[model samples]
Target: MYSRRDERNRHGRDLTFSLLTPEDAFELLAFETAERAWFEQHIEARKEQFYSSHGVSQHIIDCLALNAQGRMSPLLIRHKGVLIGRANLRDIDGENASIGYRLAACACGQGIAQKALKHLMKEARCMYGLETLTAVVSVENQASRRVLEKAGFDAVDKLPDHARVADRRLDCLVYRCVLRQEVECA
Candidate 1:
């Protein structure tokens, strides 16, 4: 039921969630390059080579491979024909997966991440047959924590000194959400 660039979920009307594809390499590269510092503030930084065309292509290929094997789900976020961010479901084991997202600086504080995340939760329940979704956020990232809270994730645990950001070690919080899909009658 998902299309190339028109996938819409119930969270909001302005955001589009589409499966990641090889065709998005360059645009994805630009978005990532522009938001590199912003992203590294809260999460791990990508290697320098990952900013290049070949690196992105290889990354897409590798992600698609995992998608084909039912091990990962990578999504691209768009707003009115512009690439804005990426939301991903990785480490997918039966009934469980880890979720993460990065938003462009311009897109942050605009409720786009919350909507994208809720849309991702729906995809997890309906498309991937996943029951539990977990997210890890750095303690200093209050915006992301608020977004997750608004999207129905509850703080479950904290990992001490689990992440390093801006040359300093920081604690990370683990958030979890359970989905209850409705059963359809035959």
Candidate 2:
């Protein structure tokens, strides 16, 4: 779990990050339902069942199982005790992991994404002992690309015709951030 007071918002509420639990199924459902259109614009399409309660419950179960095996960290972002978004560190391979995040449609304009990402990066290094983190964003997603850059990530490469978005193929930009660098000794 990670907690930090954020002063960026007018409410001045502390932001809390925690592992996704079964208890959050309903809140997750609501968040997904509300942000479905907004998210689908930038992310891959979700199954029809994923919008249902049963599917969400199963997702929660799967996330918990992955957490148990230490292969992923599925996190829920909260502000003032309300579920506002999600951030995940997945595909863990010794000191490296892929990072991903999404915010509620209403939560977009603010600096919340950048703040949450910065905090996650810190936790990834200190708590999880991670040395490097990576993210891939669609070339058309300028906002997301900016978020990654503001969070100290550098665009290392671009893959043409990388992914299929809806009916057409789109390019993807790969960004990476090294949290800690090892020093060479004499």
Candidate 3:
């Protein structure tokens, strides 16, 4: 049930975020199809069905179920009324959750990911009542690491052979942000 419209991108376009809904299946499928190759390079492999409309509809339903159970927040990121990305606060455990985000290829290098992440973090604290957020980034993915750092996450550890991507075991850097301090200070 999350929704916000006040955030904006650098280009002065409105940046909106909302909980993923069944109605978003089409746009989600389209975005996934368009960015599949770009995203696959950085993220874990997805099932073949994930790029299809039926798969996306079921995914949305599952996300909504998780949201209803207070286990996850799957948010759709939109810029100027168009889907541009997604931000998720997943695997909620009490006051903590794991954060993940992805931006469309066309939206990369524009600071949109960082901006959207910052907004998502705020929502995670205020709306979701989360106190801490964790993230894991591939060591080879410098851009994503930078985004996490820029969004105020502190690098905490490096795990060897942490992530398996495309038949390769890659190292990963773990990051954590204490949201309670930020919220209290604000």
Off by over 4 Å in 3: 1-9, 182-186
* lDDT tens readout by residue for model 2, 1-186: 333333365433467888999999999999899888888777876788989999999999998898888778999988888888999988878799899999887777677888778767876786678888999989998988999998789999999988776756889999999985432211
lDDT-better candidate, 1 vs 2:
1
Clashes of 3: 0
lDDT of 3: 0.84
For all predicted structures, in order, the TM-scores are 0.89, 0.87, 0.88
Give the per-residue Cα lDDT of candidate 3 at 144: 91
lDDT string, candidate 3, 1-186, tens digits: 322332223433567888898889988998898888888788887899887888998899888899899999999888888998999989988899998999998878777888777877887888778888999999999999999888779999999999877778999999998885556325
Better of 2 and 3 by lDDT: 3
Q: Give me the runs in candidate 2 sitting further than 4 Å from their true place.
A: 1-12, 181-186
lDDT of candidates 1 onward, in order: 0.85, 0.83, 0.84
Residue-wise C-alpha lDDT for candidate 1, range 1-186, written one tens digit per residue: 665334433224766888889999989888898899988877888888999999999999999999999989999998877888999999899899999999888877667888778777887888888999999999889999998898779999999999878778999999999876762212
Worst 10 residues of 2 by lDDT: 3-12
Query: On TM-score, who's better, 2 or 3?
Result: 3
Which RMSD values do the candidates have, in order? 5.6, 5.4, 5.4
Superposed model 1: Cα runs more than 4 Å off: 1-11, 182-186
